[model samples]
Target: MRQAGLTEALSGLDALGRIWRRRGVFAIVAGAVLALAVAALVLLPVRYLATASVIIAEQEPGANTSAAWAQKVGDPADMESQLLVIRSPRLLRQIISSPGVAGAVVSECERGRLLGSTDACQRLKTDVGAFIDHVESRFSVASAGRSRVINISYQSGLPDVAQTLANALTQTFLEDQRTEGANSREVASSWLWQELKQLDQQLREADDKIQKFRRTKGLMRGANAPISSERLTSIGQQLSQAEAARAEAAARLQEIKSEQERGPTDAPSVLQSRTIADLKQQLTTVSAQLASAAGVLGPKHPSILALTREQASIQQRLVEEMQSIAASAQKAFDANTALVNSLKKQMETAKAEAGSATLDEASIESMVRDTEIKRQQYAELYKKASELETERRVLRGSTRLVSLAELPSKPFFPKKIPFLAAGMTLALIFGVGAALLADQLGARLISPPVPVTPEAPAQQVEAPAADEAPAIVPELAESVTAPETATPPPERSSHLPSVADVSILACLPRLKSLREMSALGAILQGHQPLAIPRVLRLASEDTDFQHALRDLVHELGLKRSARSQRIVVTSPDAGDGKTTTACALAEHLAAAGRRVLVVECDVSHPAFAEIMALPASPGWLGALERGTPLRDMILPTAHPSLDVLPIGATTGPVGDILDAISLDGLLAGLDGYDAVIVDTPLPSQRNDFLAGTDWAIVCVRSDRSLIEPAVVTVNRSRALGARDVGIVVTMTDVEHRSPPVVQTAPVAAYAGAG
Candidate 1:
């Protein structure tokens, strides 16, 4: 698991290295994106933002209670509702239609006209709806973070205009709230007044109905009751008096009768009479006189007889008076009895009349109750209407202006520091992404070649004998080198090539001075050999360049079997030192006592004749077309072991001859050489000769050749069946005379192609 993780980490590092190697691409892409961002920032129009705030105070009219004043402020739903109301179309329309607001918008539009925004200016001037829409786009309203305060903002190119519009919007909302409250009260008052009038009419009609009912029923009210009721009471009182009088008279008559039965002298009536009393007095006097006379004249005197007769007469008068008193008592008793009977009959009649009056009074009482209720209702409504009118005059809204907007000193949009920072960050991200894409798309070359660990050995396939395959031309087999000697090659050495030397050569610094080039020329002269070109002769010296070449050969040797090898040297473009590298490698192989063959496959621009210092003659193509013996076209260099087959003078396109005569068959005919180096043109130009080769070395010029084509050449070589592929960076500047330290660690292959 740990090994797997380390491998993954190394893979990631390798990918990043590939990107870093193409830093030039990152710089170009990032620079272009940043420049575009800056241009857009400068060209954009500047806008100023101004804000005004209001505190929403919700309160009931005429309410001074602590509960009402301390009601929870800024209910979330209520605040949201209020915000929506402020941004409502009706309120916005009113704000835009106001004189001050309209003028400010007009001024802004006119300013726009001067600034070449004629279309917008003309549309705003001609269409009021469009003007409103434009203003709405710039206007904004929001609550101030869980508080009752609300913020209204506006954006405009002109700072003063923004401030004016923001303030106007806030003022308009407040006024609208006040006006809405007043209108509500006014409507309520109107309804109350109408209701009161209806109640008044109902009360008057009810009173009239009561009065008319009374008149129709003949129900007249007295102090405490109806008149008929009062009369019934009076008759009852009179009947009671008559009854008492009759009772008293009857008792008197009875007493008088009893007195008559017992004799008139003991009767109460007789005793009460004045005439009886007078007669009694007279009788007393006579009796006294008679008694004296009788005594004096006992025997028959005339004076005594006369006195007795007078007394008798007085007693008779008293008896008649008693009879008269009895008769008067009877008459008075009878009269009282008749009067009581009459009063009783009248009381019965009055009771019947009073019963009818009671029914009528009940109905009148119902109407009177209804009338009273209507009157109370009318009074209540009248009072309420008055209160509503008073309240409407002092109505207040739930919002008040907390602060007016001030003119902004700077634009809200296009903030310099933040805008540039954001732009740069985005540009950098895009640049990195683009660089990675370019690397992935084969637009950049692979990283410096690394020494790969040797894998399982490949099975060696013996080459076919020259006599077994048919040659393209009859003389091709005779042109091949003689067979290898019977002696086996020297044993393999234990010394491994330095990995650091190869890396330094692959990532060389730029050669900036002519002095460096002259120093390189001096080094070339110091290591001269007569048989090879001056450029190829430098490989014999123990320099940094020579060590890089040896490392490359050692790395290739690890991949190949211990047998004859075929190597192809090519480049992504022209003039990348492809020929020099091919010749030098061949010379090195010859110096090591190996028989090597150099075949110049670049027929379009062949350079072997001049490099070999040989006179012009019919090259390989001339010998092929004329069917000349292949052995006659074979040329030898000063090195007896290294030979060359140069591309002769051509009459037409090299592609047609190459297609007609198979190069593979021609190479197969050669059997004796230890190694064959075939130098070809750019991979894009011609790559048919790359197939079936043992190794392909792509030559790249440091700081001059692009990584894109170099990477392309490596991939193409691998695709064309080259058993192994590598890169060599040539023409690189040397910083010092001394070589770099050799690293013993085995290097990894190029991440892109491997």
Candidate 2:
């Protein structure tokens, strides 16, 4: 994990390094920010401050009230309210409007003496609001530790002026608070009055509802079920009493009636009657006399007759008394019957009243309960309204002043050290941020550009005045040796050194067009057009080819001076026209009336042998077999001066020709030739024979050459004894501006095919 973290850290550093590599952009941004920081340090001014403090007491609701419901606790809301009140606009304006305030400000201005002219003083006198605003702008109020103590501060150029403003503002705030309290009370009283009246109306409405419901339901109000129940109890008691009376009366009536029905003997009241008793007593006496008379008269007639009259009168008197007793009993019976009927009627009336009272009791109780609830709510609201009214009358401001502001001895702003430090910190932060952004944007633009079409070569940006000038990429400092222009192909006129001094020459481009191909062919075939033809060899008389070849000779310093005549041509890889160039060069040199010899040295892919129509015999081996003198091996071509020495089918490796065979004797056979061109294999294939050659020219296929391999080939040949070496391009595709020339008529192979 630690190793991974280190890798990640290194990767991040690499990314940042790439970004910071755009040093020009980073320097400009960072330098500009740093300059600004210095300017800020130089130009910033200082400011002074004076501080004041005011104690703002927190208000508690209903502090003076004795009722538990009216009491209150400490509130953050009230403290915030006090703060607002202190900073109120009306209060500030009032401070401005105070006596001597304008004079004090103008005097301070004049005394400070920035503008001493009387006109300036007069102008300052008129703008009291400006002074107020100036003071207010610098003023700040803050409380510490949630305490009642608030610190009021103001900054100004002058300490005395700042102090004066703070004290005046504090006084004004105090006055405003008191005035605000009074106004608040008035507003509260008005609101409470309206609310209290509303509560009263609600109470009245409740009472009215109770009264109306009682009247409508015919129920007793105020007292509820208890009244109805008590009435019912009274009625029930009366009914019971009436029933008892009626029962007693009924019993007496029944007894009286039975007595009347069974006569006075069955009734005690009849028997106890005063008139009946008196009459019975008399009748008893009369009956005794009659009995006596009847008994005597029955026996003796006159005396018995008188006695019988007496007895009969006594009997009549007794009958009359019994009749009187029966009459009294009838009267008593009638009185008892009337009393029972009256009691029964009274009981029924009392029962009906109780039944009606029961329904009235239920409705009245519900209405009374409802009214009581309304009364309770109305009472609560009324009490609150009254308390609010009382509060409105007696309340005062809750906040107070603790201490007034004093003059400050020190400046509060534009601290030199801190400001400078902050400026530098911020500048660095912003500078780094900008550099990162620029780098990121540049990365986005670095996507692969579209491939440039084949047109005129691209132009380079102008170099700086001095070599030491900073480059966009520092890595490009060592590339000054390359020519800063369009470089042409080097095959025809290789920009080479003298034949004695040269190793490798410049490279060339591929030839695709007929013009370039023909020009190249002409250079190979020389001014003399061969009678023999193969492929494009017929069009060998090209003016451009001759001009370019002359230029090559001039660069080599070989047109006038020659160190060696034996030159070999080879490529790092095949298909590079090595044999063709060698064969053509020999022909051109021979056409100038020089004895030129051409050899097909490449054992494998022997192209020169095929084109020359040579028989299957290695030229060097046969020349050796022809005996001591080697003249017969040097063969002639169709041209008067050129010769072809084709490598034959030896059926063995070509190294024998380079190393095992007599290399000196082989060249001795060419002593009569003025120029010799050898077509050799790639240096990598067989380099021993290439080293024996006097000069070497490497042929590079322009369209398909690898730079590293070509360079390796050049260096390797130089390392060998063939120090005079040059490079030539073949098969290039470009503008064909050179025209071919008509020199000789067409001919067969085996003639002028150097």
Query: Best candidate, lDDT-wise?
Result: 1
Clashing residue pairs found in predicted model 1: 445-707, 619-648
The C-alpha lDDT values of all candidates are 0.69, 0.57
**Best candidate per TM-score, number?**
1
**Against the true structure, what is each candidate's TM-score?**
0.47, 0.37
Find the 10 residues in a row with the least total lDDT in model 1.
745-754
> Over the stretch 440-538, how does candidate 2's per-residue lDDT look in tens digits?
688679843333332312222122222112111112213212223322223333222211222223222222224545777746643332232243252
Global Cα lDDT for candidate 1? 0.69
Tens-digit per-residue lDDT, 78-156, candidate 1: 7888889888878877776665677678788787665565666666655767877888889889888878899999999
lDDT of 1 at 377: 81
